[model samples]
Target: MPSQEALSAQVGAVYTTSTGAPVAEPYAAQRVGLTGPLLLQDFHHIDLLAHFDRERIPERVVHAKGSGAHGVIKVTHDITDLTVASLFSKVGNEAPLTIRFSTVGGESGSADTARDPRGFAIKIKTDEGNLDWVFNNTPVFFIRDPAKFPHFIHTQKRDPQTHLKDADMFWDYLSQNPESIHQVMILFSDRGTPDGYYMHGYSGHTFKFVNKDGKFHYVQIHLRREGGAKSLDNDTAQRLAGENPDYATEQLFTEIEAGKFPTWNVFVQTMTAEQAESFRYNILDLTKVWPHKEFPLRPVGQIILNKNVQNYFAEIEQAAFSPSHLVPGIEPSADPVLQSRLFSYPDTHRHRLGVNYGQLPVNAPLAPVSNFQRDGAMAFNNQGFRPNYQSSLAPLQYKRKAYEDVKHEIWLGDANVDLSYVTELDFEQPRALYEKVFSDTDREHLIYNLSVHLGNVKSPIVKARQLSVFAAVSKDLGDRLAKAINHPSVEPLAVKPATEAIRYKLKAA
Candidate 1:
C-alpha cells in the first residue's frame, strides 16, 4: 500500500493562482479597503470558484450507489480447450481484478438494502485484454426483449408527476407483461434482499466462452460465494435501511481491511450450437436458464477480493465495464439484450465520463493499446508520434488466425429484422420454475411477499391483470393470491372488464 505522503505526491494539491504562483493566504479575499468591494483581478479567488463549480462529473443513470474492491482472479482449472481466453488458458494464472456491487435502480445516496437486484461486475486485467463480466446477482431477468428494458426500469423508478415510487405503475407493467412472473417470483422470495455483499451469487446473462482455436460455445458464468447465500427478512431489512443505509458497503470494506477476504468459485455451463438448436427453451432468452441436469457446471476459476480501494472517487467511480471489451477466444451470443448492451454500456460511459475514459488507470487494459484512433478528451497516454492512420508507408502487418475450428450451425428461421415475439414456449420454463423448482416453504414466502407489495398497488385493474399472469403460471398460485388479497377468482373479474377478459382467459386456461 502506498503511504499518504507518496499518494499526495502522486496527486499534487496546493492553493495557487492559474499562473502557478502560490497564494499567501487562501481564506481571505482581496479587497480595495476594509469591508469594500473585492478586486476583480484576484485570480486566486476566480480560479477557486471556477474549479469548484465543475468539480463533479455526471452521476450514473443507474447503479449509482455502489461499493468496489481490488482483488485477484486465480485460475484453478484449465479449460484451454473451451476458451482461448488467456485468463483461463493456464492453471494458477492470476490477473488483477476490480469488482463493483450496486443496487440496480437506486440513486447515489439511496439505501443499499433496498429490495432490488445487485450488480456484480468484475473487470479482469488479462494479458490479452480487460475482460469484464457485467452480471447481476440473479441468474434470470424479468424480460428478454431489449425494447421492454426501458419500460421495466421506469416502473422501478420515480413516477413522472409525483416524483416518487408508485406501486400502481410497477404492478401495471408486470401484469401486462406476463413474462415477468418468473423473475417476480424470485424477487419476492428471501433471496431478494441479500444479507451483505459477500452472501450472494453472480451470473452472466448471455453465454460467451470460446476455445484456444477460436471455437466458441454458448456459456453462462456463475460465481457462488464460499460462505453461501444469506438474506435478511423484510422486517430486518427495513429496520436496517432506516438505521444504517450504508451497511452493505461498510461491511464489505471493513472485512477486507481486517484480512477476512471473501472468495467465490467460478463455474460455466456450455452448450454447443447443435445442442442450442434443439433445446426445449430458447437458449438465448434472458428470462430462462438451461437445465443444469443437461449441461453440468464445469469448474473454471476462483476470485478472492482482498484489497479495498483507497480512494473511492478515483478507483470506483471512474471504473467502467462493457460487453464489447471481449478478447480473441471469447465472443458474444446472439441474444438481443446482450447485443443492445454491447452499444449501451460504453455509450453511457462516454456520457458520464468522457470519450477517452478507457485511458484511466482503473479502466486501462494491461496489454499495450495500439490503434488508429487517437486524440479525445483527457488524452493522457497518447502514443507519441505513432501513425494515427494505417497507410502504405507505415507497412501495417496483420496476423490472421484460422477460423476452421470455429463451430458452425444452420439457422432455419428468418436471419434478420427484429426477432422479438411471444410464444407458448416462453411460458414453459417459467411454469416449471414456479411449480417444480420452488419448495412449499418457498411458495408460501413468494405469496406473502407478492401480497405485501401488490397489496399496496391502488389500481384494482392492475392487480387483477397481475393475478391473471400468476394464474397462468399456476392455477393454484393465482387462486391463492386472489384469496389473500380478498378478490374473487379470475372468472368473476373477467366479466367486468371484457377487453382484459380475453387476455386473462387465455392465461387462465
Candidate 2:
C-alpha cells in the first residue's frame, strides 16, 4: 500500500478540512514539542474526532435494513381515464426512479431472510413533483386500527425486560385483535420469505385515481414481478438466514451490478364511487383485500431497476419515502392504516433524516422546488436572497387550481369520532383465505408455522385465546392448532407446560 501523502499526490486530490481549508498534514496532530503534549488548537484533529462521534444516525423503527437502486417507471397503458397523475399521462411517458426494498420487523443488522413482510418503497421523479409509493409486499395489513400499531409492533420486537422475543407478547396481541388473522395468515405462509426483492408485490392500503373531469375510482396498486411470484419454504428460508444473513440484500446489488436488472409489471384494481357504496366489504378496511373476481387488475405501467447506486449511505440510507408524498390525481383513501401513515411517515423522516430531508438529492423532487420555508437543520440551499416568507415586496408565482372534489369524503353517522367496530365480518375474509385460497399443503404449513411459535407461548390463557381466534377462522384449523400445541382449554385450572400437556393428554386418551 502507498503512503497517505503518496496516494493523495498521485490521485491529484488535495487534502482539506471538513469546511474546505487546506490540510498539509492531517495524519499528525499539532504538538507543543517533539515529545511534549499535543496541542488542543488542532482543528483538523478535533473535527475528525467530532464527526466520527456523530457518524451514526438513529435506525428506522421498522424497515431499517434495506437496499436500493436507480430505476425508471414507464407508462405502458392509458391510465388518463382514471388518474391525472402526469407520471402516467401517456403510454410512453417515463420517469426516473429509485426503489428500496426491506424487511419490516428487524433492526438494521438483522437477517435479510427473516420471515417478515418486505417493504416496497419507490420514488418517482415526475415533471410535476416527487411521488413516493411506500408499500409493503402484502396487500392487507395486520391491524386496521392505528391505536393498536405501537402495541402490535412492541409485541413483534424483543420484550422490554427479557431483551428477547416473547411468544406470549406476540400471540396475546394477535389473539385479542382478531382482525390481524388475515395478515397473520399471509405472514406465516411461504410468501413470508420471497425468493428475491422483486419476487413479491406491493400495496399501501387503497388509494384513488382522479381524472381531469373529477371522476374518481377507488384503486389498489399492485406491482407484479415480470415472472409470477415465488416463495421459500420454512427450511430453506431458515437455512439461508444462517448461511448468509445478507443474502437478499447482496443478491439485489449483485444482479443490478451485473446488468441483470429486475422489473415489475404494474397493475391497478379500480372501483367507482357507486361500487364502493355497495361493495361487499368496506374499501377503507386495510385488514381485508379486494377479491380479484370482484375487481380484476388492469395493466398500467412497468418498474425497471436498471442502475445500482455508487454510494449506499448517500443514496440508499439517506433515501426518505412517505406515503403522503403524492402528486396530483393520486390521493389517499379513508383506510385507517393509510390515514395514520400520511402523517407518521413524514414525521419519522423528519426525525430520522432531518427537517429538510426532502432537500437531500436522493429525495428532492425532479421539478424545481421554490417554497416559503427556509432555515432548518441541514439546509443545503436556503433559496438564496429571495423572500423566505410571503412578501408583498416580491411574492412567488402561484399555480392555483381547483381542488379535486373526488378526493373528498362525506362522513356519515357522527362528526367527532367513533371507535372502530370489531365484528364477525373481520373473520369472513381470513376464513375464505384458509378454506378457498390456500391449498391442502399450504394449510398444513400455515398450521405448522403457527404451532412452532404458539408452542413457545407460556401463558395458557394467551395460548387458548389465540387458538380460539384461529378456530374462528376455521373450526378444523383451530382444532388442529390446539392439538399441535397441545394447549389445554381456557378452563379454570393449572396451566401445564406445553410438552407436559401433550403427554398428559395422550395418556388420558
Residue 65 lDDT, candidate 2, scale 0-100:
86
Q: What overall lDDT, based on C-alpha atoms, would model 1 receive against the true structure?
A: 0.79
Compared to the true structure, candidate 1 yields what TM-score? 0.89
Total clashes in model 1, counting residue pairs 3 or more apart in sequence or in different chains: 6
Pairs of colliding residues, candidate 2: none
Which stretches of model 2 miss by more than 4 angstroms? Answer: 1-12, 21-26, 32-35, 411-420, 488-509
Total clashing pairs for each candidate: 6, 0
Estimate TM-scores for all models. Answer: 0.89, 0.90
lDDT tens string, model 1, 163-191?
99989999998877766766787788877
Ten contiguous residues with the weakest lDDT in model 1: 492-501
User: Could you say which candidate leads in lDDT?
Assistant: 2
Error of 1 at 453 (Å): 1.2
